[model samples]
Target: MKQRTKARSVALQVLYECDLTQHTPGQALEQRLAEEHLEPELAEFSRQIVFGVYPIVDKLDRYIAQHAPEWPLDQISVIDRNILRIALWEFAVAGCTPVKVAINEAIELAKTFGSDSTPRFVNGVLGSLANRLDEIRQQFQREKAQEEGLSPRTT
Candidate 1:
């Protein structure tokens, strides 16, 4: 695995633990990283991806629900939900990571840690949702433009 992809998986494991135990990412992952004897550079990358998702999680969840509304918020598995959040944050929100890379990385994570069905489920939901991204763009673009005095109408 690529270094960053492995880092992301490590982060996902920490994040999964956080959800299960109700611990903060920093505290939880820091302890785990120390005990696991993980490399320093990879540890930092893992921590960043895990904790970094918190700030934008609410907004990310809203869009995720919009895309996958048939499954209620509570009904969705925490691991699946967090995976989508990480993938979306990197590809859709950050605009720095490529969509293909995010999706591929997520599939690997699911295969490693999620259910036997998880890899396919992860790809299906994320792939379908990611494909319908014009709506996501429209939602964010309009809001952002309005915030910046670029509303799409004549004064």
Candidate 2:
């Protein structure tokens, strides 16, 4: 496995623990990395993803909720939700990992750690999410403009 993918899976396991334990994701990640046998770069990358994503769970949840409203956050499997969190963090926020890589990695993770139905469901959600990515991105841009009260320019 690629170092980042390994790190991300570790990070996701931490996220899964957080979901199961109700501890903060950052706290969970810190605890895991402090004790785990990971290289320095891997540790940092894992920390980056966990900390990078921890603060934005609500926003991520809302985005997933919008795209897959039929699957409530609570109803979504833990593995699938964390996969989405990782991919969405990479796609929507981190911008470090490419969207295609994120989706592929997520599908692989789902297959490995998720329920039998999770692979397809993960693929479905991520694929659908990818389809609307530009639209969703535009939605964010528009909202940011509205928040900043910046009017659109017209020549």
Candidate 3:
């Protein structure tokens, strides 16, 4: 697997565990890092994904729930949910990855970690959200600016 992809996998593992158990995300991430030999950059990327998505999980879920109305947030598999969170965070919140790359990476992760129909499910939901990617990103930006006590920049 590619290093960045491996990092995302690690993040998914941590998120999955934390979602199901009382294990703290920090502790889970620390344990996973110890178990795996990730390069510093990749490790940091994993940390970024975990922390980035962890705090805003409910917000991500709201978006996921909107797009995947057939599956309640609690009904979505932990692995699939975390994979979506990772991909959404990468492209939408962090704005560090392209939409296509994030969606493709998400599909890859789903194939590896999810059930038989997971890839298609993930693709469908993300593809639906892709139509409003810019709008979502802008809303998140506004929320962040409000939280940080800064005015959102006008384009």
Candidate 4:
């Protein structure tokens, strides 16, 4: 697997542990990475994602709730929820991974780790999110510009 893919896998496992056990991401990542032994950069990336997702989970869940209203956040499968969390982090916060890459990676991870319906469900939610990408991106850019004391981008 690619490095980021492997990192995402590690991050997902750690995130899953955090969800079930109420462990902090730092604790979960330390133990999990020791077992997994990924490369340093991959491990760091995985750690960043684990830490990134936990604090903002409430916000992420709100987005998930809005996008997938029929399936409440608590009702969603653990693997699927973590997958969405990671993808949403990349899409909205990380700002380096492309949106399509994030979505596709989530789908692949769901296929490997989730129930039979997981890939399709992930695809549906992410596809819906993708449709709003431009608007979301603009909003983020505007916020960033404001943070930097500059006007928001026009395009």
Candidate 5:
């Protein structure tokens, strides 16, 4: 697997463990990375993803619930939920990864780690979410602006 792909896989595993085991992100990631023995760069990338998703996990969950209302958050599989969170982080939060790349990587992850229907489910939800990414990003920026005591930028 490619570096980021491997990193995302590890990050997903870390997320799964954290959710199921109630372990700290650092603890989950450290344990998983130790077992996997990934390259330094890949490990660092996974670390970034785990840490990035940990803080705003509730926000991400809320966003997912808002977008994929048909699929209640609790009912979704742990693997799929974490996949969406990681992809959403890449798509709307970090904005470092390209949108298509993020969505495609998410689908790939679903195929590997999720159920038979997971890829399509992930694609549909993420596809819809990606369509509204700019709107979401703008809203996020506006919220941040308000918190910083500045008027939000007008488009």
Candidate 6:
């Protein structure tokens, strides 16, 4: 697997564990890192994905739920939900990845980790959300600004 993809997989595993158990994301990530040796950059990327997604999971879920109304957040499989969260975070919150790249990476992750229908489900939901990615990113930016006590800059 590609290093970054591997990192995402690690992040997904940590997220999946945290979602289903009482384990803290930090502890789960630490354990995963210890088990698999990743290069420094890849490890940091994994950390970024976990830490980025964990804090705003509710927001991501709301967005996902909006797009995938048929599949409520609780009803979505753990792996699939986390995959969506990771891709959403990468493009919308972190703004470090292109929308297409994020969506494609998410589909790949779904293929590897999810059930038979997972890839299609993920692609469908993300395709619906793609039209409004900019809007979602701006909303998240404004919310972050509000939380940080800064004026939200209009783009």
Instruction: List, residue by residue over 9-122, the lDDT tens digit for candidate 2.
Output: 889989889878878777787788877778999998888888877766787788888778778889998778989988987876667887888999998888889989888887
Clashing pairs in 1: none
Candidate 6, residues 1-155: lDDT per residue as tens digits?
88889999999999999999999999999999999899989999999999999999999999999999878788999999999999989988898898899999999999999999999999999888878987998889889999999998765
User: Which is the winner by TM-score between candidate 3 and candidate 5?
Assistant: 3
On the 0 to 100 scale, the lDDT of residue 98 in model 5 is 92
Each prediction's Cα lDDT score? 0.77, 0.81, 0.93, 0.86, 0.90, 0.93
Per-residue lDDT of candidate 1, residues 31-117 (tens digit): 778776667888876776776787567777887787777788678788888888888777776565787888898898888777887
Q: Please tell me which model should have the higher TM-score, number 1 or number 2.
A: 2
**Per-model TM-score on C-alpha atoms:** 0.78, 0.83, 0.95, 0.86, 0.92, 0.96
Q: What's the lDDT for residue 155 in model 4?
A: 48
Which segments of model 4 are wrong by more than 4 Å? Answer: 137-155
Error in Å for residue 142 of model 2? 6.2
Error of 1 at 83 (Å): 1.3
* Candidate 3 lDDT over residue span 59-99, tens digit each: 89889999999899889998999999999889999988999
Please identify which of the two predictions, 4 or 6, would achieve the higher TM-score against the true structure.
6
For model 1 the local lDDT of residue 38 reads: 64
> What are the C-alpha RMSDs, in order, of all predicted structures?
3.4, 2.8, 1.2, 2.7, 1.6, 1.1
**Model 4's TM-score against the true structure:** 0.86
Lowest summed lDDT window (length 10), candidate 1: 135-144
Candidate 4, lDDT over the whole model = 0.86
> What's the best-to-worst order under lDDT?
3, 6, 5, 4, 2, 1
lDDT accuracy of residue 145 in candidate 5 = 84
Kindly provide the TM-score of model 3 when superposed on the true structure, using C-alpha atoms: 0.95
Residue ranges of candidate 1 with Cα displaced over 4 Å: 134-155
Candidate 3 residue 145 Cα shift, in angstroms, is: 1.4
